[model samples]
Target: MTASTLARRGLGVTVVERSGDTGRTGAALSVPEGLLERITGLRSEQLPRTLAPGVQSWFAVHTALHAAAAADLGIHFRENTRVVEVGQDTDAAWAVTAEGERIHADILVGADGHRSVTRRHVAPDKSDARYAGQVLWIGVAEESAIGSRGWPASVAFQHGAGYTLIGYPLPGADGSTAPGARRLGWALYDSSRDDVLRGSGALVGSVVQHTLTAPEIPEHTFEELARDARRAFSGTWRDAMVDSIRRRAVIGTPVAEYVPDRLVRGRVALVGDAAHVANPMTGRGFAESLLDAESLGAALSSNPGRGDRTRALLHYELDRLDAVREFVRSGR
Candidate 1:
């Protein structure tokens, strides 16, 4: 989507990715209404039919329930493109090589990921990515598993001994088409870095075990942990949300990280989690990434001959720094 947006403005764009295919496997994340409205330029009438039915209400991390309307937009995900190296010359053009194929452009954008190769190649001296002492397990739960609508449809942060569990339903892909189900976001806390490296089920098992074995789970109340799948999800609500998590499914450990200083380097820039990743505890990554793409696209497209593309890049970097910081602080 970012590449297409930038390309429409006559900017040269070649998306280089490491994946051999578009791995559309991860659970859906949030896209804030204000950002969505601005980016897609759609009205309230256009939203309902365009959006998925699972989104019930717009709940904030610190605020009240509100209605959010958004425009219809599609993200064109490209696969099989892996960017291995990025180099900028004196001419201000970037030379990017991926899978032995080289492409030259006046600007580079690394929307790759947290362990961004472009970031490492450009800002080698930057501090290492740190874990936020939490590992998240995410998957879809059947509507049958959830009997009632106990909490808001958004994120619920359940804090316990040495950790926090964040639960939320991912819109649309709740498996409602053939079999009705809802996506569940579980952010469990872990003190050991070693445990996080071991992956999802281990992390979840640790959470279950923690709640069962530990006498006192700090900050986490039994009310948070005591949601019986049959009663709370399936038996109570007319439209119940259930557990979609399959037996022994691995929902990769989500370790939080961020880049506070900048969002780009030379011709290369970053969007999405590659640039600034917030803890899932905040539940704002998808919203922020979509915003970044639109903001960067607007800056690049609107300003022509304004001291080169770097000026726009710098603007994007500066604009997002404070927002990312604020989001991170709130999650903490």
Candidate 2:
């Protein structure tokens, strides 16, 4: 988003992605109306609608579309490039890629996400993300499968003894909302420390990690999750839960949060999850990231050339720091 905004303002922007292509995941996300307008310069009516009201699109579609837009704006994207380290001197900041290439820029924006190397370079003493003591298991299934069981197009929430389940409709893989083509995305949150994390060996400090497609997730785990869902929910929701668990891959991750003391150091600036990682309960992670990109671009554009660039960057950090704090507080 920063690259697209800067490129639109006629600034030379290069995006370094560690992946070979725009990565796609089965997980779905809500794109807020305000973020849609700010990033695309389009109103709600002008944007593609989602099955869920007020959401612009899912994560995969948004990613692909944003990448295409950035490409059209002449932003250079260097794929298969991983930044091993970030360094800056008085004159400029630089990133050292894993391939031993030094890329220099007057300003270094660390949009590298939660495990940011740039954040380490800028604020070495900052605290790491803390686990929120909950694990989330997520999967998606065909809407038809759920609808046939009489599930309505609405958000459903169920709480068991020690778990919470949320299910909602998402557009199809191609971003379609047509009947039988839509998808149901569900997340089951379990706070009980059970065999799932222990068997996977994903407990790294406080954070637990396990992808749906990873081999560590044994088949019995899925069966257990499905069985638990059946025992917790009733009717269409229960049936849908079982079907989704049986048919789709289930991804798991420990809920975590990280709010840094500061957002800038020297010529380096942090954005998105690099600066603050709010709980998913807030449903504002992606929105906050977009706002950070917009704020950074606006700050840089307001101070063209090298003169007063540092001041503008600091202003950007200050502009967003309060909002980020509010988000973290409210989410907690």
Candidate 3:
């Protein structure tokens, strides 16, 4: 989003993507209509046709954004580039890739996710997002895999057996909303999974290490989740969860919360999850990330020169810090 916005503002952007693939799993995204247009000032025909509003799969949204950024000549994209170190001086900011290549720019913005390495340079004192003491077991199940007698509810919240399940009727990755083509996306919040998280190293000493993939999930844990699903839900929700569990398609992610005290240092600035990470329960993390990207671009554009780089970045930090802090604290 930052790349698109910056590129549209006539600024050159180099996006260093940590991974080349977009098959990542995430909760459903609330994409407002014309989001890409709003960010890039591009017409509908200029963006990917697969880009649509409403509830979308994470993969779908990413694919569209990738397409949009790639189409812009001002945006240079590097795939599978792991940035190990980020540094900045008065004249320029740069990233040292794992391959030992240093990519320099007038100003560097870190749009990296929760485990952002760029955040370390921006706010070294508070780089890690603290573990929120709960884990979310999330997955998307196809309608054909878990047939329902009627159309599923648009959304549902169920609680039992020390778990809270959030289920949503999601369109297919292809954006199909037909009864047999739609999918069910579910997130099972379980506070009792700290042992599993610690054992899997997904949680370490109050910080999040990583997500637990299906293959890493223990047999006993799967069995327990299956039973818990039965006790907690019925009909479509239960069926979807059981199907995903039987197929071992779920991912367990420990929630992390980060409230930044500062978002910029020298010529380096932080955006998205690198800046703030609110609890997912607020359903405002993604929206806040979008605003961060937009705000950063606007602030920099308002002071578009090397001489005013630090001032622009400080403006972005000051503009966002107050609200995002409230997001994490209040949501928790």
Candidate 4:
């Protein structure tokens, strides 16, 4: 996104990604009205519309849309390339890839993610991301499979003893609203302790874990999740939850937050989760990333040339830091 925004400003930009393909892990995202235009110079109506009041779409669809726009603007992309470290000299900033390739730039933007290598180099002394004592199991269910469950088109939430369930509609695979073409997106939040997860044999590793696909989840765990859903939700919401659990691929991740003491250092600037990571409860992760990219582009475009680039980066950091802090605090 940062690369695309910069490219639109007539700046030469290159994006280095470790994955061979674009990210497809995230499920649905709700985008507030006007955010698309504010961030990407694209109208919200240009994308698929969701049954959920405002704009909502699959995360992959949103990503592909922005990626296409960026490509149209002539931004360069390097896939399957892993960046191990980021370093900057008095003149330029550079990324050292695992393959031992060095890519230099006038200014390096670390939009890597919550576990950003650039962030580690930029602020070695900063605290690491902290777990927020919750894990979210997310999935999508075909509306056709859901049958006549009478699910609401708008977002709905149900709070349980130690968890919460959120449901909303998503555009279909083709980004359409036709019957049997839409999907119901759902997330189940479990706020139990690590001991509970461990006892259930679910916490197999790190603080943050993802299953990627539903079939990969243990049968026992899936059964327990379904039982829990029955207890927490009712009517169509519960039906949607069970349908998604049984029919769709699922992904789970421990909620975590990271707020860096600084967002910029020398010629390097951090954006998105690289600078701050808020819990998904804020419903602002994707939106915040776009905003970060937009802000960086505006800062650089306004203060052109090498002499003012560093200062502009600092200004961008100040411009976004407070809002990020609020998001982190609120999400927790």
Clashes of each: 32, 0, 0, 1
Clashing pairs in 4: 214-250
Q: Please give the lDDT score at residue 136 for candidate 4.
A: 80
Candidate 3 has an lDDT of 0.85
Query: Model 1, 1-332: lDDT tens per residue?
Result: 46545654655455555565222323444545544335444455644422433332222210111122111122233346666777776455553455576666677787766667677755667624556655444334444455335524555655444444445554333223332344344434545434434432333322211111122222222223233333333322212212333332224354656645767676667777667766665667767776788788878875667357788887877777678767656766
lDDT of all predictions? 0.50, 0.72, 0.85, 0.74
Candidate 1 segments whose C-alpha is farther than 4 A from its true place: 8-12, 20-26, 34-37, 40-78, 95-98, 144-155, 159-163, 171-187, 196-246
How well is each residue in 1-332 modelled by candidate 2, as lDDT tens digits?
A: 77776676667777887877544334566665555456656555665444223422356555654644654556777778999999988898888999899999888888877667887887888736666777778777777666655655677778885788777767776667778887777778888754567566666666534333535677877777888887778876677668767774566766767877889987889998888877777777877888898898889888887867788789898899888978877778
Residue 126: error of model 1 in Å? 0.6
Candidate closer to the true structure by lDDT (higher is better), 1 or 4: 4
Residue range 1-332, candidate 4, lDDT tens digits: 67768877888878888876544543666565555455456655564343223535556445655555554546777878999999988899999999899999999998877778888877888735666777788877778887645757778887975788887777676667777777777888887646545444445454333333454556766778888889877877777778767754666666767876888998999998888989887888877887888899899988988888899999898899898888788886
Model 1 TM-score relative to the real fold: 0.67
- After superposition on all CA atoms, what RMSD does each candidate show versus the true structure? 8.7, 2.6, 1.4, 3.1
Lowest summed lDDT window (length 10), candidate 2: 48-57
Instruction: Write candidate 3's Cα lDDT for 1-332 as tens digits.
Output: 99998888889889998999788564677777778888878788776645676667788888888887898899999999999999987688999999999999989998888899999998888899999889999988999888867657677788888888888888876877777888999999988878999888888899898889888899999999999898878888899899888888899988999988988898898888888887778776777888888898889899998799889989988899898888889778
Give candidate 2's whole-model lDDT. 0.72
Model 4 RMSD in angstroms: 3.1
Best by lDDT: 3
What would the TM-scores of all predictions be? 0.67, 0.89, 0.96, 0.88
